[model samples]
Each structure stands twice: as structure tokens, then as C-alpha cells.
Target: MRRVAMMRATFPDALVTGHEPLIPAMTNDPKDRHVLAAAVRADAAVIVTTNLKDFPSAALAPYDIDAVSPDDFLLNQLELNRIATLTCVVDMAHARNRPPVRPVELLDRFSVIAPQFAEEAKAQILNQSEPSPWLIHQRREID
Candidate 1:
């Protein structure tokens, strides 16, 4: 797409490397150990991962970090803020008009990844319990 033609490779502001030695022995997967170690280095509370089995709770509990699938993460976020989450999804759907995706169709695709989130979001939307767009709180001013 023309929008992405000149885009540079993106990276997080913080970079963690050479964390192999910091990895816990309980993190059995040699390939993914560095990911946990990097999380520890970055002091992240959660690791959004599709490979949860590789980062079991037993290994992550000591580091006070959690490994969750993208779906589970989205579900947890939806639970925390249904209005904002749905609003975001709706906005994204609207923005994707070139391909012409409906909000429900987008939600349907989300259902494949996060069934619980999709179900709960649908229920909330259909019930009209979510506040209007204007009701969402303003972003907090950064210090």
C-alpha cells in the first residue's frame, strides 16, 4: 500500500539484549528464554504472545510477569474498558473503508481470535450499556 511504502522499520524505544544469562532455568524453552529475560529486563508486567505454552506461569511468576495470548490480552483489555475498546474497533473499521469492513464483520473476525471478547463486546453493544463517544474520559495529561 502507498501508505506503507516509505515506512521505516519500527522498534520499541527500549531495547533489551544479551539477557540470556538472566533467563530462569524453569523457562524450559531455550528459544524463547531470551524473550522472558528481555521482559524481566524491561520490567514489563505482561508479554503479549501467541505462544503461551512456551512461557508458563511457573517460570514467569518469579519475575512477576505474565504471558498471554493476543486474544486473552484483548479480552482482558475489553473487560477493563468495554466502551473504549469497542469505540476503537469501530473507529478502526471505519478507517478501513477502502476494503469496506463493517464493524460487525470486524467483530466476527475478532471472534475467531478472541471468542469471549467478541461475545461480551457484542452483548454490551447490543444492550446499549456503553456510553456515547462524548462520554469517554479525556486522555490524562502527561507530566
Candidate 2:
């Protein structure tokens, strides 16, 4: 099972559930389709998954399940957790097994992939008005 650390911390009151392994269809099994179906049955609005192609939004339209990528899911989590999206980006960049980024250069790096989101992330970081790395990492989220 995925740790989903952010979700656990932010949504302490949320009713999070996961299904046991079930045999899926030959073409559909092992895809996000099974998870999406379960979420649909549970009346969930969003289906968070790393495999975006497997959980194409078109297939989930009937169930109103909007498939979101891991990055997007993490950004949404940051917004809800009161942790600046930029801070999360920086953390993600550093946490990655590859190269680490300078905290000051976060916007420069993230803008390449998501320019608008980078701006929003910067705004959230600047407006928070403090430079505590620990505070940036540890947020007390409200549901």
C-alpha cells in the first residue's frame, strides 16, 4: 500500500479506504481502472493515482471521478495543509533521488513544467511571511 503520508496528516478526519487485490480484466486489470471504479462506487470526487494514462478522465466521467497525477495531488495537499505549494515543490525536488535544488531557485525550476502553478506557489510562500523551514515542512491542517 502507498504510504500517502500527506493525506494521512492533512485529512485525519477523512474516511480513506482502499480495496484488496482483485483480479481485473486482461486489458483493464492492474490499471487505475479498478481503483477508479471503487472510488466511483464510493461516490468519491477525485481519484489520486500515479498512473494517469490508466485512469484517463474520459473513462471516469460517468462517475465524476477526476483523475489527478501524483504531483497535482501533492500540490492540492499542500494548499489544504497550509504548506506553500512552492515549499512542497522544493521538498519534492530535494526528496527526489536525483539532483537537489536551492531553496531560492524553486520557482525557476518548477516554472518550466507549470508556470502558472509556479506563480501561485510563489505567492503562497511569500505571503506566509516567515522563513522557518520546519514550519514549512510541518503544517497543522484543518479539514
Q: Which numbered prediction scores highest in TM-score against the true structure?
A: 1
For candidate 1, write residues 1-143 as lDDT tens digits. 64444233334445677666787554647788888888888889999987888888988898899888878898888879866787787776777766887666677788876777777766655545654553333111100
Cα distance off (Å), candidate 1, residue 1:
12
Estimate, for each residue in 1-143, the C-alpha lDDT of model 2 and write its tens digit. Answer: 34577767768855435433322421233555557646755678887665677766557676666877655765676668645554565666556454655543566565665555566665665556774675455333200
Name model 1 segments beyond 4 Å from true.
1-26, 129-143
Error of 1 at 98 (Å): 4.0
What global local distance difference test value does model 2 have? 0.57
Global lDDT of each candidate:
0.71, 0.57
Candidate 1 colliding pairs, count: 0
Query: 12, model 2: CA deviation in Å?
Result: 12
Q: Of the candidates shown, which would achieve the greatest lDDT relative to the real structure? A: 1
TM-scores of all predicted structures? 0.69, 0.43
